[model samples]
Target: MNSKKLLLYSSVFAIQGLSNAVIPILPELAGEGSTSPAVSSLLYSGYFIGALLTLLPFGILADRIGNLKVVSLGITLTLISGIFISISDNLWVLGISRFVEGLGCGAFFPAAYSMIADWKDSHQSLGEFNFLLNAGLAAGVFFSGMLAELEIKTAINIFTLLAFLSFIFLLRETRGQTPDNSGRKKDEYGTSKRVKPPGEPHENRTGFKPGMYLEKTRETFFENGFWKLWGISVVLYGATGVLNSNYADYSAGFLTKPELGFAISASYLAAMLSSLAAGKTKAKNKSIIRAGIVLAAAGILFSLKVPLLAFFLIGAGGGAAVLGLVAAVSRVSSSGIAMGLFNTGIYAGLGLIPVFGSLFIGPLGYESVFLGSGLVLLTTLFVKFE
Candidate 1:
């Protein structure tokens, strides 16, 4: 409810809203005479590709420079990319722009989560963040579908405008703020108190060594049951990624564009609600994760037959699972690096898993891909969180 949290949440909502605004209209964006399904897929996945490459580096940079600075830079990139997407009709151009836009997200998330990791009630804060994240996605899908009826590029233009506003607000809010270097500690009341700035001569300052980066990454990945958390992210996100990528086209056979958007939006809405619920719950993180896995698997298995219910289940499950995973990872040392690694797993799943599934769609069919993804989610039940 503080100004900082409000700014972070609002900025996330705008950027994420733009990210999925194009999904329902992927075919139109791909253009006529483009028979290749790959073009449409590229239009959708390019954002994730950009984010996948930059998340970790930005996390490291956030640790050095400042989180708010990276967040500001990310909003700037998103604004630029939104303009590019709005003006360009070329498929390749749009693809590249989407990639750049994703880079903006890659920059934002690790830094933002790093900031959140400094909070007193990180679990509840993360839940609230995730809730807004899903709300943005749902709004993007629903409004894009509604707006595209007026004009194909109308939704893109509108989201770009929102991004512009968010960027301006971010600049005003973060002006004159410097990076905190007290190493992620909080007072008894959960408010952060700054130590000597990073520029001060301190024994702990190693000045961005490559060996230290690798060492911290290795230690973070192996410690505190984080690998299990990372695996859960991969499976859960990968399953949803497969759904997000393929389900639109698959469902097109039965549903109209608006209806398709509604179905997808329903999933995100469910996620938003569930995330809010998860944050307030006292259940163990692992238990929540286990329940989430079951619900998601059920959703994926039934997606082909019951589109709305299936997606809703997936969203609900994903929301809870991610809240648990992120809350768990927030406990590790070097919050920036931990968040970087955690998000790297997310983008890897979102960007790469669908590409992996695409290979099987030709030989094994869409059903195989869905079933495989569902089974993959189920397999994670065996992963020990302790």
Candidate 2:
């Protein structure tokens, strides 16, 4: 693990940890006698909203300015927003801060993926990255629960400190350095490697034009079966999102906070393990995706009765599905724009789907949402993907 890689991975861990740290304490944040479920759900979704807005633009900027540069900016924003969330009690302030924090994540992921995709063993590298990503989510969930009794903000403060440190380290590491592909070297076979030149359009061309970014983004969407992967991402992540956004409140009826946290953490832990495993598997991406859909659908359908088991299945399946999807997209176009759009599908599912599901909780109850999500996942199995 070189310092650069370590910094990148640790930063990801910190950001993800920060993102989920608030989950266990949502009730506390909502204030006593606040009856609206929408507040809690909106606060939860705010981060994703911010990420959704920024993912694509930041990705394009990463290609032009450099991935590390974008990552550094992300960390800074994360640190700042984490601090704001820790001190504020106003719902609007917290909501805005959460959005800003999500923007930080939106900046980090596409840039990070672009950098990782350029590595010699991109599949394995992406697997490791996803592993750490879930580990961070798990740790955040667990620790937030553990700390909630002591102080609702403790976990946030701790993770914010991590973001601060990561930002400082990144600044020092990148001081006086400019990001480019100029340092790329030939492989062991002595053949000159082909590295995507910095600032190049998604078409892999040398020169850029005024409207090339939009043109290439449109082309990338229609090329190499990318839309299929994007569709899969939305459905797969949407199922998990429904669970993630509602499960904490739903389980409050039966489980203690710590137990609830553990259950949620279990899902992330499963995902972490599955992602690591998926990286090493030789299975085709399509096959892996299909299998993941099955597992995830089962998880969602049975979530209310077997909360822990269901969550575990969801995490495991989601990890594998994401690994396959990301790997597939990377194969088609490793450009920042392509990675950005791919992640947009992810945030769309995570942020928007849950809010949509919440609308039906009054009339249909949580079970209907879960069942509908499951059915939706199953339906995707029949969709043709080239």
- Cα lDDT, model 1, residue 160: 91
* Model 2 global lDDT (CA atoms, 0 to 1): 0.80
Per TM-score, the best of the predicted structures is 2
**RMSD list, candidates in order:** 4.2, 4.2
Candidate 2: which stretches are off by over 4 Å?
A: 32-35, 117-127, 176-210
lDDT of 1 at 381: 96
Q: What is model 2's C-alpha RMSD?
A: 4.2
Tens digits of lDDT, candidate 1, 1-386:
67568778888888989999988888788765424345666777789889999999887777766666788889899999999999999887898999999999988987788777667777678768877888889989888877777888787888899888887777667553443465432112224434544433212556679897899889999997888889889878888787777776667678777887888899898887887788889998888888888988999988989988998999889888887887778765445678788888888888777767766676777788899989988999999875
Question: Which residue pairs in candidate 2 have backbone atoms (N, alpha carbon, C) closer than 3 angstroms, thus clashing?
Answer: none
Off by over 4 Å in 1: 1-6, 32-35, 116-128, 174-192, 195-206, 330-334
What lDDT score goes with residue 302 in model 2?
77
Summarize candidate 2's per-residue lDDT along 1-386 as a digit string, tens digits.
65557767889999999999988887677665534455666778889989999998888777666666788888889999999998999988998999999999988887887777666667677768877888889989999888777887888999999888888777766763543465522122111124544433334336646497789889999997899889888888877887777777777788777887888899898887787788789999888888888989999987979978998998888888888888789889976678788988999888887778777777887788889989998988886775
